[model samples]
Target: MLSNTDIAELLARQAERESGILSRAFRRAARSAFLWPEEVANVIAQNRSLTELRAIGPFIERQIRHWIDKPPHSTHRAPTIRRDFVSLAKARQLLARKPAWAKILRGDLQMHTRWSDGSGTIAEMADAATDRSYEYIAITDHSKGLKIAGGIDEQALKKQGNEIGKLNAFLRKSGRNLLVLRSVEMNLNRRGEGDMSPESLLALDLVLGSFHSSLRIVEDQTNRYLAALRNPHIQILGHPRGRIYNFRIGLSADWPRVFAEATSLNKAMEVDCYPDRQDLNIDLLKIAREHGTHISLGTDAHHPWQLEFIELGLAAALKAKLPADRIVNFMPIGELKSWVREVRGRAPRRP
Candidate 1:
């Protein structure tokens, strides 16, 4: 039976051959495949209409039926933007092969609450993590530099910390083992400088530095990645490439050298698992694995329920055969903190 990915590719190819609203609809249906919760074939086996899926209408449903009946032959390669993303259905299939791997996940390294653009509050996010049985989850809200995302300033960050502390106490009192880690997605400029003060950053449990601007530059970005890795405040580099599916192609760089620098520094490059933003996709992940680079997985979730997105990153890591030892999420809470402390201690003091 064809997976949702196969149906998506068929729709995308069909879209390329047409024009106007019909073509746009096909493209939208293609992108929607990643978000669809069930396999189209399974839905068909149950005698369900394809319109039950997102972005599928009667017309698109009929087209999907045709493809399902007689799958089209894929003659050309998918563009970089649309390639290598594993849908949730596919991720589940891969994880079933090693049931133990999913159980080892202790926490989610990156997420947001209403403190930033996220729709959920800290308490709501915590509740969701508890459902997943995660021992901890980092609240990496946007820092002041990313004003577009309603980034928080130093004072606001401290206030957020207090809130997290209270929540932790409550969880402890309630016999819940979850810890909400304090972290911020500090915005980095093209020069690899972060907007938040170094002192403020040091106060957090962990820090993730990311590039929010100059993402569309077509030139190489090896130097940028190097400088960001060397920045003393950041323990993890978030979404290293800034790529979005079928939209931004992301930056080009000598990835081997980049991963080597990350490895030497003992810092991690994130596998941002957001469906539309699966940066550090499988191809680059293979290189990182070859260099034995530390890999951090984060759903980059804007809402609590989106934590399920981690499966995509986990599957990508599994596909690349990334060693379990190098994956930070596999570490227990204490070990994870120890890794953060080690990296922070090695960073040079800022003036």
Candidate 2:
């Protein structure tokens, strides 16, 4: 249904987003006029949109030589999730042998920034992510409630959105493969309820409901979790049972009920890939896969560099021997969006 020019513009945007050097060169050259010769390279990169990014073969890389008139302060750091089976020291070698693993790490990621508690601003994080060849990044700083994290209030939310818009525009300038989505790492407070009011939650492009405190409450935890799941805005239940590996206590999750709730409600169970703090263990993942509950892996990254935790997720999945079809989060953005829609205002996807 899209016209050819529309396709070109979209590809141009994609090309510009994926390649910073080319974007800068094209933009500068365009500044001299309306378009530039570099736009051709942008089209090839757009090749991926048609093929779901698989079309952007490695052979098409265009070498662009440019010097930054104003060099960026720092580069985006790519987070690498060590396969639970391998030590950080040896992850690269194992990763090298498995090309499939690389793709998992390279998938879309959501991360935090100093806008909340991250080490940098949204732009810095976005740039760093693009540097690692990531396709997209979500700026999910903390929402109000966790003041220590500098959670955003109503007025601040507007400002944060503005700031993110600029970062997205910057990504546009770079002609790099990057997308910026406005999101929040909502806290599940003492009552096991999300901090944001419904109005605030809907404003976000993406929302993740997480539990940071009151995790020790064994009695009300399940009821509390259900409260969050019933909310349409609370898409993925961040680390379903807040477990900290073998150290601290974890939420006592009722799997049959939880997975059943997730499937029927179209709610996703998160397999947070943070080390020493992996919630939703391998066993639960197996249950989730078998029950056909859509699973989304998240970094729950506090810092920008931790976005690459998908490797940890992949390792867990591979250990569980999960197939690619069950991962709803990694589905194409359009399909993922549709799935989200189907879940909203509908009965559970399963009983």
What TM-score does model 1 achieve against the real structure?
0.95
State each model's CA lDDT, in order.
0.91, 0.60
Assess every candidate by TM-score: 0.95, 0.68
lDDT of 1 by residue, 1-351 (tens): 678877777778889898999999999998889878878888899998878788999999988888788876763567777788778878888998998888888989999889999999999999999999999999999999898999999999999999999999999999998999999999999878999988788889999999989999998999999998988889899999999877788888999999999999999999999988888899999999999999999999999899999998998999999999999989998999999999988987656
Candidate 2 — number of clashing residue pairs? 15
Point out where model 2 deviates above 4 Å: 1-98, 104-109, 190-192, 345-351
- Candidate 1 Cα outliers beyond 4 Å, as residue runs: 14-24
lDDT string for model 2 (161-255, tens) is: 88878877877887876777777878777555677776666676667778777777666366677777876667777777776532355777567
Model 2 score (lDDT): 0.60
| Residue 122, model 1, lDDT | 97
Worst ten in a row by lDDT for model 1: 71-80
